[model samples]
Target chain A: MERIPILRMGDVLLVSIQVDMHDRLAQTLQEELAERVVKDRARGVLIDISVLEIVDSFIGRLLGRIASISRILDAETVIVGMQPAVSITLVELGISLDGVRTALNVERGMELLASSISLRTQE
Target chain B: MGLESNSKLVEVLGEKGRVSLNDWKEAQWAAIKIRREPITEEELYREASDFMSLFQQAVKEAFLSDIRDPVWLKMREMLSALSISRARRGFTPTEMATFVLSFKQPLFEALKQAHGTDSGALLSDVWMTTVLLDKLGLYCVEEYQKTREAIISRQQKDLLELSTPVVQLWPGVLTLPLIGTLDSERTQLVMERLLQKIVDTGSQIAIIDITGVPTVDTLVAQHLMKTIAAAHLMGAECFLSGISPQIAQTVVHLGVKFGDIVTKATLADAFGLALKRIGLVVIKKSGE
Candidate 1:
């Protein structure tokens, strides 16, 4: 089983999914990300899925689950670089991913996470 | 009928081809004149001559009862071209069918002259002529109908493209002004175009101004929400603008909840909010 590499940028965990994710891979990523966020004391998780061309209902739900798990772990998850077609498909599939924060690209996702973390600290 | 009458019909068409073509052209000219059609005499002559030669060749080679046979391929192609051209030139189906049916009278005259003594052969030849010409006339009408349908479908596609235009208001702001009813098909097109534009321009804000949209029912409201959700999924904020009081009432009555999505009474307010979200402000310059 090939493992997806999760890079850490400062307090943010960057996960760029360049390959198609199957059930096992997504499940592993979810479990590993939860463990990594706790161990590394990461404040945010940025997921880049621009190269992901196809997303079924399973992947959509997995994204929502990942976001919820990160939130519970005291880390914000911002999904970034979602393609237009993927977003349209997700909407058509009626998977709104209600609680997840999204951004246009990695840079915006970082800015979002940084501001959100700063806001929480200010509060 | 027997093959003799078929050959006899061909023989009369071959021998008196000039006179029959002349009569056919005269009849077409009279009809065009009466209808004040803009067809030139030379164009009519050319079309009649081309059709006459193709018809003669096809009748000689193929069975008279069936024009769809491969033997009449050239004839069908010629008629399809003629029918489509006439259809584009604003010719009615009756006028197009008449262009083929007018040949019947002249050919009947020639058949009378050739088989006058034998009423049996003349009657069979006339019947074959009528059947073949009627089939040809109907083929023209069918082709005309197909052309009309092609034109209508093409216009429908063109209208779809023309209606949905994604315009960029500022560097990171885009606006989509919908001008008609929001059916599923139109909504799908608008959503696709708006999403693609958001990706292409990397616009952070999108304003959908429905000022030109006359009404909004539950279905339309659902479509709007879906579009906004899709835009949000792509990381762009969406604003619904230009809601009239009546539409607001209808939306409230329909129990359609916009939830946390922003709604505005006009595009200007939406634009102002969009600018503020992107950290921009429009202020008038001080004049001397």
Candidate 2:
């Protein structure tokens, strides 16, 4: 739950989550996430929401809005390291995180991030 | 504005000295004013004032509420709706007007046919057929208006039914961000439409951002799987966004799992991921 806003390694921006995601937090995430991702100037985004145990309506819509902005910026965002318990709770609660992308462990997420950085370099 | 007096109805009736001048004159004038090519609100208001001058304030209020002048839009809307239905029924306007013109034979036959049954009681209450039919037609028009409104609302609801009443929003992307309970029907619908959208748009990616989703059951997980699978077949990739902790708990508790699908914490991250997969960058080179 360390509220690390930005974790930059070369070109990729890894955003670390530190609290349960309610609406206001979700809005902040979009703004902060957008700011960081834009700074990469369209490289990639890696968001780590492992510490967030719950997400409510505000956070969910804000996430969608943020994704829309990312598309406009021509960048990529990869969510990594979702807790199994959190995933199940969100599903039961009728949450739609899975509709965003495939859930990867932190290790896999970092690997994907590293690979994307390399891929961008190659491009 | 001047005729908005209570004594206007008595005065006009007194001037004309006619008991049956209800459909007299200016009602038609006001209706015509409403239908002009470039409708003038000022003219309409003037016609309405004249029309109201022929009625008592109470009657004027009732008539205004009933007829809703300037009636151009309302009348046009009702007639157009009737025309659509009439097309289905193979009924033509020419036939109706012709029947009205030669109303004698039909009326006599209708009365004779109805005389033996409940027509006795109905006849006791009835007076003039012309007035009765006009009132009945008014009722029919009102009913049609209600139905049309309902259908339009249903269409909108059908489009963005699940998450939060999704509107077409933009030209390309049709988005529904779900927040509360994913029952079986909603899941099925979301899956079905998302698949159809892939076919419709030829979009390579469909993002399902679910940061607000509180829980996921086995069926909901299955619903997601089917949708993603369909999207892939249609040459589109689906993005699962907003993986909250509560959802994780439900997925695990239900013991349902998906294999090797793309996911992100936020939609922005998901979009970023999609971009990266396609090898697209947002960087610039030279100084401006």
Candidate 3:
């Protein structure tokens, strides 16, 4: 699957997939998306996979792997607006996201990144 | 076969009227089969068909009556009540599978009379058989999980007859082969397990094999040491086996000595050492 459109508001990059994704593409996603997100050393990342109705084992595992790579590049990853079905399915499947952070929607994602960016500016 | 049993059947149906599939099967298989001689296929088919028509007529009359003089409006209420009954007795998959096994005349007779599992024959029956089967499957999975959890918990409990921990390479004696990372909780568990096994087994020796364990840091080594000590307290000797060259070097580098502990290079060697120590040194059979 192709990378979704990139939207930038100030230093924070809103990088969300327009299409629902599967598990097999996680590594390739990290390799490809990492380059775009890292360009000019962007401030923070906002991932919106909320439009996705279902999340199986493979997709859950991929999301975790993606979040870990995002951490290594010195950018905080905030997963925005996971559907209730996705949340329930993830729980039933016992998918663990120990290191990943989350938000309700893009607005909240922006709010979270704003704080992170301001904290960096203070330093 | 000679005399018609309708008069007797009418007499029974007059008092009770309705009979379940199980009761009907008992009446047929048990009451009739033993006393009378075995009948041919022609006799079986004739009797089966006779019962099917009789059953179908009775069901139609009852359903029509139920539809008219009924306070329970929805069919779902009746189905729900049946569901509750199925729950109380704990329905097995084999029983559920039997409900779908045949659509032949005798089975059709039993189903029509019973008003259960007949739903499978109709695409628009009172209740879909597939739905019932799905519910039964989920129940089976739940039952299996509960059984698995119960077995694990009972093993962990302090009961000699109940508990059975995995003891690798054994009939009477057992070897608890330790491998991988050991946290604080795992250390405690190892000690508890070794002590429990020693108390339960009444064996003279135990071998804590560490072959699959890649590296032994201080925490894991300490856990092993604790396990050995716990076993010793119960008057059983503990043998440490499968010390790799890399692990040996790490131990030397860490300056952690064995402190006069029983050590062996391989599992085979450990067995040999155990046998020799127990005075099985000389071969009584062909090979030494």
lDDT of 3 by residue, B1-288 (tens): 111222222222333444343443444444334535344445434443444344344433342322223422233233333333433445443432232232232333433554444444332221322343344334434444454556677765544322224373543355867665556665566556665555455455678788867888876776676566445423356799998999888988888767647988888888777776545664678775
lDDT per residue as tens, model 1, A1-123: 878899999999999998999989999999999999999999999999989999999999999999999999999999987888899899889999988999988889999999999999798
User: lDDT per residue, candidate 1, B178-232, as tens digits?
Assistant: 9988899999989999999998999999999999899999899999999999999
Q: Residue by residue across A39-118, what tens digits does model 2's lDDT show?
A: 76756666676567666545654554665676577555666544434443444455554334333445555665567667
* Rank ordering of all candidates by lDDT, starting from the highest: 1, 3, 2
Please identify model 2 stretches exceeding 4 Å from their true place: A1-123, B1-138, B150-206, B212-220, B233-237, B249-255, B275-288
True contacts kept of each: 0.69, 0.00, 0.00
In model 2, state the lDDT of residue A27.
65
Give per-model TM-scores: 0.94, 0.32, 0.32
Q: Write the per-residue lDDT of candidate 2 for residues B58-97, one digit (tens) a residue.
A: 3334333333345333443444454345334443344222
Write the residue-wise lDDT of candidate 3 on A1-123 in tens digits.
465665766776676766767554555666666886688476777778757776678878777777787678777777776654465456446664556666546775677688887897799
Between prediction 2 and prediction 3, which has the larger lDDT?
3
Best by TM-score: 1
Q: Is the docking of candidate 2 incorrect, acceptable, medium or high quality?
A: incorrect
